[model samples]
Target chain A: MASLPPKHRLQSSAADSAATGQHEHHRPRGLMRWVLTTNHKEIGTLYLIFSLTMFLIGGVFALVVRAELFQPGLQLVQPEFFNQMTTMHGLIMVFGAVMPAFVGLANWMVPLQIGAPDMALPRLNNFSFWLLPIAFTLMLSTLFMPGGAPNFGWTFYAPLSTTYAPPSTTFFILSLHIAGISSILGAINIIATILNLRAPGMRMMDMTLFVWTWLITAFLLIAVMPVLAGVVTMMLMDINFGTSFFNAGGGGDPVLFQHLFWFFGHPEVYIMILPAFGIVSVIIPTFARKRLFGYASMVYATASIAILSFLVWAHHMFVVGLPLVAELFFMYSTMLIAVPTGVKVFNWITTLFRGSISFEPAMLFAIAFVVLFTIGGFSGLMLAISPADFQYHDTYFVVAHFHYVLVPGAVFSIMAAVYYWLPKWTGHYPHLRLSQWHFWLSVIGVNLTFFPMHFSGLAGMPRRIPDYSLQFADFNMVSSIGAFMFGLSQLLFVVIVIMCVRGGKTAPAKAWDGAEDLEWTVPSPAPLHTFEHPPQYRPVEH
Target chain B: MVNVVEDRRPQVRRTVIKTLVVLAGMCVFAFALVPLYDVFCQVTGLNGKTASSAQSLVHQEVDDERTVTMQFVTRGAAGLPWRLEVEERQIRVHPGQSAEVHFTFRNLGERSLVARAVPSVTPSPASLHLRKLVCFCFENQRLAAGESFTAPLVFQLTRDLPPEIKAVTLVYTLYPQENDTVTAAMPDDGKHIDAVATRRWADRSSGGET
Candidate 1:
């Protein structure tokens, strides 16, 4: 594979001497670079901005939903429109918001962290990011179609999605197919880059936790995204060809849909959160001014969680009806997850115990994730109880549980990561007061919005309903108010990010007193092309 | 040179072991795929046995249009209390045609409710069938109280319903009423029908509860 001969290298060196510093001037300039470029960093920036825009759009949809549910009796939108809100909100946040945000972070950070010139497959990376806008365009365009957007919820289960689905479902499925392809290609690129392009002497164990988690997450993506593609394809076939893969008359079972979905679905959940674990793992240590506690255990625990994720998916289906023995098996396997998860939490707390700590916005979000992710985990355990799930399944309880995981768990970590790395990316610190307000308001608003859902769910309020009875009125009202506040608080984050980007007080190479990482070893406002040569690896001493 | 050769030998051995282990793992993984898939199906109810049947009820015709008061009884899943209401409260259908009815259900419990409608015919062995056109309970119904919306069901006398079947009765089961108070008020007697039961039956089936 080493195609360049020694003579060619020598001649190139002679040519390089002739134009030593002129290379920078010759770099690609203007809009042509952005539109028809293969630069990893530029594509990464585009992905981040695009994801942020989608996040706001999805947040608006959520605000609409919360507004209607605020006082109960259809104040903001009709039932059909409300259903569209829920459906589109879920689709956008998952595919457009969270996943893209993580990919953006990966694109920006992975090459620099790994001491590579750029992503191994730069063209594929550009293709992945560009596919997103096209996919989302198709998805959003469905809202204007006849009979409105998909109202059967994001899961798009059988029969409802097949027989009763709107004309827009075809477009929805095609859009998701494009998105899935993008995800798969992105995952493959990440894997190949990590495995094949590491700087000489940069071993697997020497890599940062974020890189490792993403490597595994990429594997999970390759393994299961195809399954998602398979299921959705079957859905399309069922819709078009009159196949019964999910229909009874066609000698197929509808519950099979749930099984196949959760297979991909469970791993998909981990895909969203494992990067969160990596993010927290990085941020917690930086704030604590100490090497991570139980580093090996953290790695093993993450691997254990990924493996356990497959076994425990049936917990989602306990109410769908299964044999008692199978139920017990799934229940126990699901509960066992709490053990490894507990290990991660304990390690984080121990890292924080005696170390000098400062509550920067990043640290604030990290600590909040520790507390709230546990809440989500506890609710998951509750749902794991097969008999207990008979009550909680598909109710507001389940809704509250996942929101706890996703919002406080995944979304907060993304915020923390942004705040933590903002200095490095921008060469300046973000506005402190605004960042603090963003943190506090998000903390309060998120809890207010999701907390009452537990009560309403326990009160027998089902999820995905356009409207509810008078009894659930108060909690829904509080939640809706909380949701609006939460939505508005995110705008503060956007402002903080924008202000930091436009330029703020210049930062030192080492931005935080406690921060210690190879990334900080480089100059702030990282060079367009970074670490052309690998840095020496030195283990941190406790 | 001798020392470097010795180091290379161990590296080679380690690489061989790693490769063998990975190959073994791959084989195991490939072997497990089918069983794992089957288990996945069974657990997720992908087998279709656990799902509600879409088979319509055999339709029956009644010779008379006399106002026959058909009673509905409902019991919800445990720990979920529901209240149901119909917009018109009743419907009149011709001997050969169908009628559409709308019923709304509310969750009065402090917790979220997961309820499904199990449509049963009142006269056993009668050929009368009910076809749901639009229903909230088709998959499952999640209702937040102070939150209520109507679900519509379309049904016709399948033309095969026994002529002897004059009126059809639909029963809904709302299990696990959220509060003990709600459950205690109604008890599990064959006769007594409460708000939760009335709501579930109305929302689930097309009949008035007395």
Candidate 2:
């Protein structure tokens, strides 16, 4: 029996399991249940809760950096603390907040969208979500250590992050290794689920854009997260093992660190946003009451963008003295990426081009995403001109550019996703007036904060500085005020989520009249068990 | 449905193992970039950096079909008082050919000084294949006031030099060993590789002599 082929083993196991019953007949009670749970929805809830917590914690670090940068005189925190703040803010937001939020959404939504009962490997899903808290906790603890946290910034160049690093940098390396392992495991689970678990009639093309995008993003995670693991392992060896992988004095090249980092990093950014693209693609058409303008084109654009991300990493290092040919090559390749990105923007806009259109809280955020993410993209294109990046590299302009793409671009899509699906999860609608207020305030607050950085950066202010000269003082103040306004307003978002969860206007199975995906076909406040017997999947006509 | 779940588990296991293989492959690629980038730089002369440091001279026969122009450029460090002159600005040599070129180092200041010249080759793709039989830049030159010395450079280009490279330039920048200049007046501690010759040069010093 042990040497039997898979078919024979399956037949024997099926006979044994059918003689018994399903294993989740009764779940444990209290906190222990969550600790030991292998259910996808419960793990998704854990991921969301954990992400929300990290988002606020990372936001606090950002606010402290802003507070210190408010007047240019360094009134509040020391330069060292300010450096730690900036570094922690970037690391936490990227690894902790943004990525986990997407994974949480995928866990909750992927199976539902594909008409699968649960994630392919539910135990691995639990393990992946649990790994985040352990990794981040170890990282956050570094701030209390004698030399303080990793202060070379999130891109953490060598020598600075190595020879000049804090004693706790080794711990940072270990934690990232753990997180990288978690990301790979999570990605493997998702790819397995999407490939293996869809209902009988659903073909690859029939899957929702969200599922499709996550599929691509999952592939990206598998490919690049290992590269990240390798680079960090090199950093570990350089730190403790007397290796010189990033040391120039010992025959190693520091430029190699940048090469490996942005290799993983550029794709890591796409990992953050591709799922957001999936989210926005789902929301825009659902509200506009039209079929997505180009479904196949949207999928193709995502793939092309992921592929192009690999080729354009050197654009970030334009000022690092790359050869003329390499610079020109990266510059051209960077510009080529805009074609696919433009396709995505146009697809969303054309979906909104006119039919019956109404602005739900979710749709409003989606619309803002298209307009604002395009602004970030254009600025990115402007930076891609290798000649121009000489002026823009490491300036607040680069800061503003990525923040725009991330906050309004990725974060807004996440918000829209939450707003769109809160009804399904809670069986109640979000408080509309507060949601509108959250929308408007976030729209205004986000723009007010980052938009002025463009001007300040053009005027030659650099980033990661605790203080600046008097001339850049005014712009910093406005940005600080806006950041505060933005920070405080997100509290309203938390409140809306709580309010929706506790009680609100009850929702029907199809929460939005236009919603027609497999998820919406299930009852509101979906039952603990769904698609256990497998639901019939009908391909939606595009 | 039970059969479906049971049947697909093996496939899922297979996909998981394959995905893990891809992950491992990417990890290997990251390390591979190190050698790949080195090879790329060697091929293109990227950044004009020599890919491998020359330790010992290589023995190779010359190819006479192609003649490559070897140019010499010399510059003295900002405060070093040595002037350098090359035998020729550019000399033609065939691939796998060995040739000798001479350089004169003149001490202009009225103090005894020690100097070292660092050499770099351009059209850097040719640097690795240009083996040096003997070169004075490998060691220091000690010159007293009003003293000058002429040195010879012996080298050969490899037989397989790429056809695209028609010319290569070698540049040297000379810098005074400041500590050696200060120690010029001190008693010999016998630490110098050329301690006996350094004493002879110090004996011939004119102004600022010990």
Candidate 3:
């Protein structure tokens, strides 16, 4: 083994003479440090805490929506307000909740995983994190505008958005532009840090799945965020200017809006989940005590999924009356996506097969993700059948399919990643029993909430309706109850996380017996600066 | 030193490939701009001929107790029967001008129907101002029992309306409500009477001038 780098060597020598027990440095004092700091770990904490706050806020909006839909007679809010709740709920969850959660994880883990001193562009990292709160504040403030918030669906179709938009739509579009800027910048930072700052001997293939997946995800974000920016900019112009971009009377076709929206939208779905795939890829291997099965294939499969995302957007618009040939093409391309997705699923299951298994909270969530996300994938495949989608489009079936994917797929994975890495972040093991309660309640509440929606949709209930037909009454009641439970269960997660942050059983450097990674090799509760000199890498021989 | 040099080769190659891939991607996406721009044009209705006052309309006052008989004409893609109705049975109109008519509808059977209405106009387009005095399409409406109701549209023919142009049409589509909404024998290209035909009686009373 090589000696520590010169700077660390000096510090360790000084520590050896002076200290007998583990000592932690006082956190940098003052607000100015946070505002101007370029430290990756500090910025990472900011991203995580900000995202958690957004999650709670977005969760409240979801509760509002469920409360209104609880008995189907607009018990709590008007239909327009319900529309705003749904739109803002989706916007905040995707941008504020899931994406930033993953970015937070990246900031915490990337430097350690790659043996880098800090992110390649540390100032940019801080800027990215800070941009989130500003963007979301603008978005959330729109709720109180004169005509109320963006009552259009988060998808924000035309004519509905143009001829009938509220004054706040302009502000909503600008805020999204800001959020897009933040995402693209964060993605660029991740890409540069991963590509340029890895330790001397760490080969591209030698990096952990988390880093590899994030590297690809960063590229995806950079590629598509601008497209989202472009689309929203066009919406802004159409609203303010005399543009007939989506107005039929002005010689524009409304369906064209769907195509552009879904093009950015489809890749965006992957952007939200791909890093979760990275998180699970790391967790599953550690708990199973096996190198991830088919490592090369996993990378290739992820790349394939990203590539396939571009071709399959039209699958979202099966009912928009596309030409037959185009419909057939999109159907086959969408179905083909199932193959790479299957490869990912198969690899995860086989990694777990016949392995000495443990049910740590992180592992528990990962395993649940495997099952629940697959349920979502199957529903997605059912939707891929174009004719069937004609029936399912904008129905509760579609709603069930996405929430299953998003809540369990992205949200659970974020929870799992936090549990997996919390020891490193805090130098303490979280309260296991509280975490278990959080897990079980979330699993039950999430399934109970979304699973009933499939039946309601099959029975011909449309989505986005504040009130539903009486025929859908029973399932809606069940779903509403489930939604409340699900929302409440998430609060338990908040408690567990806060408790973990405050104090817990002190953890050793390698917190788990089987955990193997460069990150674990570092000190518990990693230093403000990490791997100031590149660490050497030796690949595990199978 | 030798191993370092050897490792550097593939790293450089990877970087080069990565660069090329990004460049190629940018190029391909740059090309995509044309189609996306076209799509943008289509979606925003930027490329098609627009009705001068297609979205909102304005109306002039009806002369009190002046029985101004008006005719309605319906036309669109053939095989789709169009319907229209007036919320009020009759309204007084100043000579050489028009007033709002409430047109209501239901698609009795299957195939999609595009409904167009030409109101009797003394003057049209630039000369006449057509105002949507009130409309329910702005909100959701459900028709009852093969039902119908009138969407109120008000307009005044400008003195400039070509005397030959005595009518204006308000067109919309009755896309067959999804199958879930219909509960009877689905018609295969069903033919139904056009509502504008009822205006024929009004036209006869108004001297069948057109």
Candidate 4:
């Protein structure tokens, strides 16, 4: 692995890129410019905007669920609709919102970081991004279908999702297949670009942590997206073709569904979070005015987490009558994940220790990600203990545990990346005052929304239910209020991106004082074409 | 730069092709997991499915000192209307000796229905040696409404069966079958046309309520 590149090398690349200023002007105009664009930046913009739209849509689905759970009685939605909301919320957030957002960031950054002119396959990139809208549109239209959208939980355990599934289940299976194909394509492009397109003389180890994580994440995507495709295809068969892959009535085991889903699913959890680790890894060091602690260790830890994710899938099936030995194997393997995760958290903290740390919005989210994501991790550890999980399974405690990791851990990291890179993307600093307001409100709102779930879940409030008894009413009420608060503050984020794009404080080529990635080597608001000529090669010295 | 990009084109294309191949293999691997999961459960005896089929059955002298209790329990899958009852609900047997248990199934549904009863074992490890010589689970049964059909379940537990397992409970759950071949086997009582009967069957299977 190459050591950290020294600062002077950046100036040379910048001068070299500036010298070759031949930006192309023959792009398609108006709607077709976006519709048929193959440029990485344009596709990146489409992915980000698309993810944000999905985020809002998924957020409303959450609000609907929250509204129904605001009291003991089901006031806002029926039990059937409640199931749809929860299912859609999980599906949309994971597949539509979070995954796309990360890919969008990767598209915008991986090429720039590696000094490539574009993604390895730009047209494929366009196709992958376009697949999502079709996949999600098909999924959403199922709400209007006779039997309604997938009412099984996001896991879609069969025979519930097969023999007993609504008429819309086949469509659900198709939509997921489309999305899985999209993910596989996107992953291939990333791996190709990273492996084959780095600037001359920059070895694999010299690449930025963001690029490193995406590379690993991309391989994971390739490996597991197909399994997802496989599992859903099985679902499709069971639903339409009368095959019994999951239908116990047909001699297929329902437990097999959990095994297959989690095989794809547990790794999918890491798919959402590993890049967040990379983002925070990038942001914490930049704002702290320090080189990242244990950069090699961080990469190893990310890999370790991805590997361990596979072995720990059965932990999710602990309550399903797994044999004792199987239970212990999954439980121990799951707990072992904490070691690598601990390394990451410790590395971040060490980077921040006694450094010239700044309280920028990006830094704030990065730090919050450290504190709150750890909270999620602790709950995860609690849930990992096979016996304790019996108490917490399907409870709001389980709900609280994941939401903490997802909202604060993954979503916050995305926020941090957006804030950290906004200057480079738009050539202007975000409105600082409004950004701070969004930050504080989001932090408070997120905590308020998910914290009480631990109490209610311990009090035995199950998840995905439209009604709870009177004991959980107060927690549900406070949670709904916080949900609205958290949901509304995200609108401010949309405003900040728009305002920063339109006009704001100017940012120089090197956006942050301590930033060292090659992305900053190009001018802020990077040109359509960059690194057309591979900049003269010189690996930086630490 | 154009030369660098062009030079790497072959490598990128190779990498993409290889990755796509892996993607296809994994998709196939997921389907492979179906039989693999069943095999895994059978080997571990974790899901109550037996690993020992008739081919693996071997001759063994009876272990006179050890007696094992075999009990029969039957249930129906969601909407199955047949009631399965064994003539001998509980029987004591020597580990290596063969035993035959008779089961009677009566279709409670209005029309003749095709059914299959799948067997499972409790304290799952015991299933590893629970061999079936002749069981009705090997084929489907069609019983007319209120008609009772009897079948024999002949099985042997190897003498090597662990002494710690004094008792084994075999649960057989009846599930309605809809195979095209079975439809011919089903004696139509002239209750309704083929289309209407099938629609009702489909509705009953999915609806959870007849």
Q: Fraction of reference contacts reproduced per prediction?
A: 0.00, 0.51, 0.00, 0.70
Report the C-alpha lDDT of model 1 over A92-193, residue by residue, as the tens digit.
999999999888888877876776656766777889988999999999999999999999888888868876789899899999999998998788777766
Off by over 4 Å in 4: A1-25, B1-4, B51-61, B87-92, B183-210
Residue B23 CA displacement from its true place in model 1, Å: 17
lDDT of 3 by residue, A231-312 (tens): 7776777778766556553345576677778888999999888888889999998899887898888989999999999899
Which candidate number maximizes TM-score? 4
> Model 1, A345: alpha-carbon shift in Å?
0.5
- Computed on alpha carbons, the lDDT of every model, listed in order, comes to 0.74, 0.83, 0.72, 0.85
Residue A122, candidate 1: how far off, in angstroms? 1.0
Task: Name the runs in model 3 displaced over 4 angstroms.
Answer: A1-28, B1-210
Clashing pairs in 2: B62-B96
Which portions of model 2 show Cα errors greater than 4 Å? A1-25, B1-4, B51-210
Q: Rank the candidates by TM-score, best first.
A: 4, 2, 3, 1
Query: Which number leads on lDDT?
Result: 4
- Model 2 TM-score? 0.82
Off by more than 4 A, model 1: A1-28, B1-210
Q: Please tell me how candidate 3 rates in CAPRI terms.
A: incorrect
Model 1 scores a TM of 0.73
